[model samples]
Target: MESILATMGDQLGQMLVVLGGALAVGFAGSGSAWGIGLANEAAAGIMTEDPKKFGYALVLLALPGTQGIYGLLVAVLAMQKAGLLGGGSVALTVWQGFGICCACLPIAIAGFYSAIWQGKSSAATILMIAKRPEQIGKAVILPAMCETYAVFGLLVSILMLNGIKL
Candidate 1:
């Protein structure tokens, strides 16, 4: 009975680690998709009005995609830390697994919201570019500003993961 309980506990811990990775990827990717979709719709509308501005529209639409990539990185790192990627799987205590999950939380939550807000900013930038094609540089800067918070989230996630004891 003791062995069985220990085994079950370990399994739950492993599941929590896996859940962290899934949440990191799923939430962040979903946000990026939402943001990109919004920007793309706006881009398409702009293109219909002025096909010549496709290049500008494309640039703006792509800005929010970085968050998805950041989320993916966090997920991969979490998996590696959880021993899901390397050949030797590590046996993690429940506390360790919970720590891993908490580490992933920053990126998962922040990336989701940042991507969405960035997309909105990018979509607005697209409209601005449509009006003043010459201000392309300035327009890009606005959306890029929204990317800062996503970077912060990525940094925090990395730091938290690094601080976690195996």
Candidate 2:
């Protein structure tokens, strides 16, 4: 009976760790899709007006996609940390699994929100550059401001994941 209960507990912990990886990928991927869509809509409009601005609009449109990549990085790191990536296993208590899940949340939440707001900022910058194409340099900076938070989130997630010993 004791061995059976311990097995069940270990299974639950493994499941929770998998869930964390899924959440990181799912939420961040969805946000990237939405954010990219938002920016593309604006880019399409600007391009329609002035086809020549495609080069400028493309740069701004790509900014929001970074959050998804950051999320993926965290997911991969977490999986590697948990020994799930290399077809190995780690004995994690439920508390340890929960801690890993919580660690992933910073990047998951930040990536989602930051990508969205960055898209909005990118859209605005797209419109701005439509008129003053010469201001492309300055325009890129606006959307980049929103990216800062995503970077911070990624950093925190990495640090947290590293702190959790298997």
Q: Cα lDDT of all candidates, in order?
A: 0.89, 0.88
lDDT of 1 at 37: 93
- Weakest 10 consecutive residues, lDDT, candidate 2? 10-19
Candidate 1 regions exceeding 4 Å error are 1-5
The 10-residue segment of model 1 with minimum total lDDT is: 10-19
What number of clashing residue pairs does each candidate have, in the order they appear? 0, 0
**Superposition TM-score, candidate 1 onto the true structure:** 0.94
Backbone clashes (count) for model 1:
0
State in Å the error of residue 88, model 1: 0.3
Off by over 4 Å in 2: 1-6
lDDT of 2 by residue, 21-116 (tens): 777777777777778899999999999999999999999989999999988998888878788887778888898888888888888999999999
**Candidate 1 residues 36-58, lDDT tens each?**
99899889998999999999998
